[model samples]
Target chain A: MISALRTLLLCALAIAMLYAMRESMPGYGDITAPIAVRGAVGERVETQDFAFGAASVHLARAVKVESFGRVKDYSTSGVWLIIEGAAVAKTETMTLMSAEWQAGNGVRYALSQRFSTVSGYLPTERLEPGLPRPVLLAFELPETAVDKGTLLVARSLVMPLAEELSIALGDRKPTEIKPSVTISRSAGGAPWTLAAR
Target chain B: MSEKRTFWTCLVALIVVLPLAFVVRAWESLRESQWLAIHKVDIVAEDGAPQAFAGGQWKLLDMRRLPRSDDARIILAEFEASPTDPAILSQGACRVRLVDGKGRRFEPVALAEPAVRKMYPEVADRPRCGALAFTDAKGGAAVRMAESFIVPAEARDLSLRIEFPGASEETLVFRWTRS
Candidate 1:
């Protein structure tokens, strides 16, 4: 009898945890997602025209996100659209920055070299005309003297085909790598391209 | 008969008590997922601790916002302080306002007390510049001020800028992009 009661108690606790975890799951919200980019170009090239009247790459409203242990379900938000990027060819070596992540387990772990560049919609004023505003392109290098553009390496994060998804507290375990980002050439914003540095 | 009675009694308690416990737990979690709990945050550094800056704002360079679910506070608005700066902050003299994708700025469309209270209860009409220096040149102790704004139920794109007093010859700009 005691064992059965304990089992019932344990089951109740598990369900409560699952439900609570789902309610408070932390996600990086509102990114025009499922953005696709091509890395074949050996040199810096702009893709403004794809299958759509759109530019070089594309971004769907769909977001591609992953958690610490696994990928979560697609967020209720619209898929992020239009992802723009510059290819570094195969030979360019990329440098990565390191950071720490706090997990739900109350343990801190190092997420080293999460990626080489920044992720988000770039600000206008850095791109050429006919280029999208703040294209969803990541850098292959850092702020160093490297001829024309800043230094960035050739690396890409894969957007996992999420079969199942869930959410959790980010304070305990923030995201380390985002497989993709959203971008666009014109939403009536300024162009975001590299300045002559 | 006694054994059967005890069995039923325990069974009834299990069915009734377990769900009640669950209700209480779910109530707590619901509260947690709602709006942020902190009503007003005033960070100030005293003595030798690292002090923070007051009423500051930061904008990212490359990030696109397509309106979706409201989950995270994408931009850490009005909370700008560098490790090289102080750790603590002061927001006694200042307030903040945010301009998001929506036309609403400081006050919402209705200007209702509850609505205004949510976004700009502590923010000043304008981000005023104060002569008070929070951090010293060496990055030691300092004072600062600001009103932290909590995100409401609305789901939309957000582009924000904070205005504060100028402290140097060049324009003070706060920019950051996270990968």
Candidate 2:
């Protein structure tokens, strides 16, 4: 009877040890998460694939995109955040395929698809090595989530073990929001400029 | 005593050997699936000679650098491939890129680009590296291909790398000095 009890106790101890190990071990998602390279607005962050710098962040009530002699206006119930930046591919030609606006409260907002027709949308623009190109990303977010936002940039949404840039947008007051903004798309390696209206 | 020894061996195998083998296999699979995984055999071209790779003969016909209005330059690479086995064409498109001395890689620009169309009008007539399979060419007929890239002016010692979907494990590299 004593031997059987001792065996049962050992078995229980082994099970407990396994349980502890399982809880402490990193999960698949955590192990494969993108390597994040953090930076602030206006600071150039270099990753394994590319280098990116966020030049300015603007908040507007509405956005007008001028593409190929046509102008399209996009108005949102929430505020529109325009992020102007430059991206340079380091080793190969690539595109910034994913961008997200993470609010201070941890709410993530994806890049607005309403302006997909815009020719110079950042996510749609191709980046070539050793050549710097202007980037413009627009996100629609609630008014409360405007201040203290962080822009998350990555090569792809599902990339594993790739570098991601997290650019922090400093705090801004409600008064800084503009009434309207216009983005003029340029042609043939020209930089796109944004104007406040 | 023999039965006792056999029982202990079985226990050792179950408790240690089996799990070790499984862990090793899983680790290998994870490494292969990672983003930085590279599994390619490289074949370098010497003296502009044609190379045999992926059941085809590849040769670099011409490489030229053209000055652009801007500081950037255009690299036009023209190559040809003669397939020994025509069935390889069905394996999908080929990927060709230029690597500079500084390890920067440049992908081919669209054939419809204004510069490519204006400077190399014949490029529009030739099939791209991977599009040869779609043509009605029989085996051993050399099909010409062309690619153009916009590169920085300082890029030098350029090499062209070609990859075919049919031969996923092999790549051909043609090296040339900027003249």
Candidate 3:
């Protein structure tokens, strides 16, 4: 009985050590995720977007959203980041999926609840297989998170076991990143091209 | 004796660990649930009852309408020290009035002795219905004032104008339309 109890304790300790080591690893969330692809602020990537090869995504441009309306100015204790682009379906009709803003410190912030008009309706927009639909994603983030947060676009808000794309928000400065449009996919597949707006 | 010792050891361990785990979970829940509870209570009370959000030198904490058969809407407004600027939440001379979109003004109704005695008999006779109750605490002072008005059905845009001593008058507007 004593030997068996000692063996059980040793096994439990071994499992705990492995869990701690896994937690300490760098890029832990990305490494364990099913798929994680990264692209620059301007560089566009042609990949399976948000799922197990659901649709092909070509991100056109991303800019910081300051205001919701022309006259009405909305101010919060935190900063607002907006990414505008287009998504085209590869095989079937596509509905916009949820995305999260993952900060450098591994804090993920959901879409702001206070600003419903922008965050609520963006994901419900539909995209045809051939035509590219415009996508606007807005996230309200703390000032600390604006410096080094990556935009992770996925199908479900809490998406699991699916390949995810990490789009870096800021290039030069923390609060502001210039919007750029440069398309260069190494795979070189002509699936869809977003029309100039 | 050995078996009894082992049983007692395990029981003591369970007793200590269970309450420790519960305390940790309760602390975590209180951190998130406290703010959610305050906002939820505010929204629910305002939906069924006559409600108003007073924005001025002091922040409005709570407001409720006392149901009376006389058809007059008696609004009880509770004000607290504004987190942004607590200095403005002071005891001073003040005047509060309600104005309609067409510039019709309505003054506050004085508290009736018979109504106070009937409903809130436990309340001190010194307290009035539409009078400001100023109390000082460790952090700052809090001021609560109630007002009564007869709002007609056709009143479009209504606002509460509060004027404090040596301070500019602030207007809290209420939208009559759905949007």
Best by lDDT: 2
Residue range A68-159, candidate 2, lDDT tens digits: 78888889898998887889999899989999988989999999988766666788888989888878889999999977778899999898
Docking class of 1: incorrect
> What ranges in model 2 sit over 4 Å off?
A1-27, A171-175, A187-190, B1-23, B30-39, B89-92, B131-134
Cα RMSD (angstroms) for every candidate in the order listed: 20.3, 4.1, 18.9
DockQ of all candidate complexes: 0.01, 0.73, 0.01
Where does candidate 1 stray beyond 4 Å?
A1-54, A58-133, A139-197, B23-28, B35-95, B99-179
Query: Candidate 2 — what's its lDDT?
Result: 0.83
In terms of TM-score, the best-performing candidate is 2
lDDT of 3 by residue, A130-149 (tens): 33444555566676776677
> Residue pairs in steric clash, candidate 3?
none
- All candidates: TM-score of chain A: 0.21, 0.84, 0.58
The fraction of reference interface contacts (C-alpha pairs within 8 A across chains A and B) present in each candidate is 0.00, 0.80, 0.00
Note the clash tally of each candidate: 60, 0, 0
**Which tens-of-lDDT digit does each residue in A1-197 have in candidate 1?**
99999999999999999999988876543242223332221224322221111123322323333333343333323222222433211111121121122233334333212221233233211221111223333222111211121111112222232111111211221122233442222223333332110
